[model samples]
Target: MFEQLGLIGCGLMGGSFALAMKKAGLVKRVVGYSKSPSTTDRARQLGVIDVEAPSALLAVAGADIVLVAVPVAATEATLKAIRHLVTPNMLIMDVGSTKADVVQAARRALRDQVGSFVPAHPITGREVSGVEHADAELYTGRQVILTPMDRTLPEQFAKAETVWNALGCRVSNMSPESHDAAFAAVSHLPHLLAFAMMNSITGQAEGDDFLSLAGPGFRDFTRIAASDPKVWRDILLSNREELLAQSRLFQQTLQNIEQAMQKGDTQALEDMITLASETRAHWRMGAQRTSKGR
Candidate 1:
């Protein structure tokens, strides 16, 4: 068991991690800090943390494990705040979605102590975000991707994997660059599309009317648009290069379908739709098999 968990950013992700660790009996105490004092207070009141820290540095002061769950944009500053107290034995990890940028931030802020930092992204979250929304089961059965830097210590990396695995997570490792590129296509671009789709309909004169008539499909497709704006804004901007590349590819496919529609090429459109349908079906089956195996 860990002596203490020094939690920074005490929001949904951080609070959830604290709760999960507590539930798993992995830590004795959790000291949490957030930019907002009220948030830290709420987290403590909610029993997500045992102690409240005034600053990020103080949060790390007597803790054996630290979790930096701040927005991607604030990662460097947060790490810098706690860098003075970062020890070789401490296991530090972040829940930032974008890996390469976070890895770069760790290198700049932690310098030689970067070896103790492991960049991680847990592939799960709800649309709502807050300490109040924190759930101990958030990471359960989730896929957690660890992007350990070249300077990362082997023991620390192993510990990170063990921690996540103990929390019922399926842990996988990938290089930061590969992690960023893959997630840009799968996660970031999808959120961008959902945001754009919502705006495209709402920006029209009949926007409200359209929304009023929207059914389950529309609601399902646009659900991600309701995600925390600031969080997604940082994620999109942080991985813009790869996200933009994926956007271009999506646009090309969309244009091809639009062209077929405009030309009244029923067979071409049918062929394209069939291919997409089959691909999606095959992927779903494969995913089910993998989940079952796990």
Candidate 2:
């Protein structure tokens, strides 16, 4: 077990990780820091942290495990703030959704200590955020992707894997670039689309009326649209390049369906619908099989 865990951010992700570690008996104490004093205080009051540090550097002073759970854009500044306190034995990781930007930030800020940094993205969260909503079971049965740099030490990586495994997380390894690209399509792009769809209707004159008439399909589709704007803004910007590529592909697909509708091609529309139905059915079957196996 880790003697101490220095958590930077102390929000939903960081708070949840600290709680999970404590619940699993993997960490003895947690020292947390955030840009806002109230957030740090709240974290400590909620038992998510044992101490509230005045700064990132102070939080990580004697802790060997540091979790940089700040926004994607704030990662560089957070890393720089504590780089001087980092040690060779320290195991540093982040909960940022995008990896390429985080890796770049680590390389620039951590310098020689970069080898101890293992960039990670936990594929689990809720529509709500903040320390108040943090849960110890957030990482249980969830997938966490670790993107280790070439300079990363094997033992450090193993320690990261061990901690995540102890928390009941299914861990997988991938390159930073691959992780960014894959998540852009599956995670980032979907959030963007949900936000866009909600805006499209809300910007209309009868938006309220339309929403009042919305059914379960609309409710389910727009659920993620209620996510924190600031968090998503950083995520979209960090993975902008990959998201833009995915956007273009989505637009092309939309145009193809639009053309089919405009031409009144009933057979073409039927074929498109049939293809999507089959693909979704197959996907559902595969997901069920995987879940059952797990």
Candidate 3:
């Protein structure tokens, strides 16, 4: 359990974290700060944070633990802003989607505080945003990745693991680069595709009919595209290289399907469809098994 907990960016993820920690009695106090005054006010009234600080630097000054639950693009600036307030004894971790940049920022700006900084990301979320949607179980049984290198101390990693485990997470260790590349493919690219698909069909001739006939499958496919514009735009820009690599793969696959269609190759089209169906099934089953097999 931690005596003092500080959080930056009190949005859905950050608020949810505070709720979960407090519910588990793992955090005595959660002091939160955000760029938006309205968000801080909401967090306080909703009991997601105990105290609202005027600034992030003041918010985390004496905290035993800190969680930066912001978009990936904001990680460096946020770390630099609060580096002076961090102590080597504290545990500083982030819930940013990308890790390489965050780890580098902490290493450079808060070199002495690196050991206390555990670069982390939880592979979980909802389409909705804001403190109002903060759920107590957002991270329950979710994969929380901790990407540490040889420069990291074992004791620091252990302490980080303790905090995440107490929050009801299944922790996994990985490198920052690997984490970014993997998520860029599995998470980022999908979001990009969904947005593109939605944009393409918005003004099409069948748009009206599509809207009226939209079913569960279509709705599900475009759900992630409905995420916060600012957040998704930042994520897309921040993780560009890895995401572009994944996008290239997607483009090639689409080209293959287009070529098959041009030739009226029903067998090849069938093969692609079958492969996609099987792949999706595997992942769906794997996710269910992970959540329930325990």
Per-model TM values vs. the true structure: 0.96, 0.95, 0.93
Pitting candidate 1 against candidate 2, the one with the higher TM-score is 1
lDDT of each: 0.92, 0.90, 0.85
Ranking by TM-score: 1, 2, 3
- The candidate maximizing lDDT is 1
RMSD of each: 2.4, 2.8, 2.8
Question: What local lDDT does model 1 show for residue 211?
Answer: 92
RMSD of candidate 1 to true structure, Å? 2.4
Higher-lDDT candidate among 1 and 3? 1
Screening candidate 3 with a backbone cut-off below 3 angstroms (N, C-alpha, C), the clashing residue pairs are none
- lDDT of candidate 2 vs native? 0.90
TM-score of 2: 0.95
Task: Give the lDDT of residue 260 in candidate 3.
Answer: 98
Question: Model 3, residue 80: displacement in angstroms?
Answer: 1.2
TM-score of 1: 0.96
lDDT (tens digit, per residue) of candidate 3 on 1-294: 789889999998899999999999998999999999889988999999999999999889779889998887788788889988777678888888888877887787777667778888888889999999999899997888889766666777788888778888878778889889988998999999999988888869988878788899998988998888878887888789999999999999999999999999999999999999988777751254232211
Give the poorly placed runs of model 1, Cα more than 4 Å off. 285-294
- Tens-place lDDT per residue, model 1, 193-277, is 9999899999999999989999999888787888888889899999999999999999999999999999999999999999999
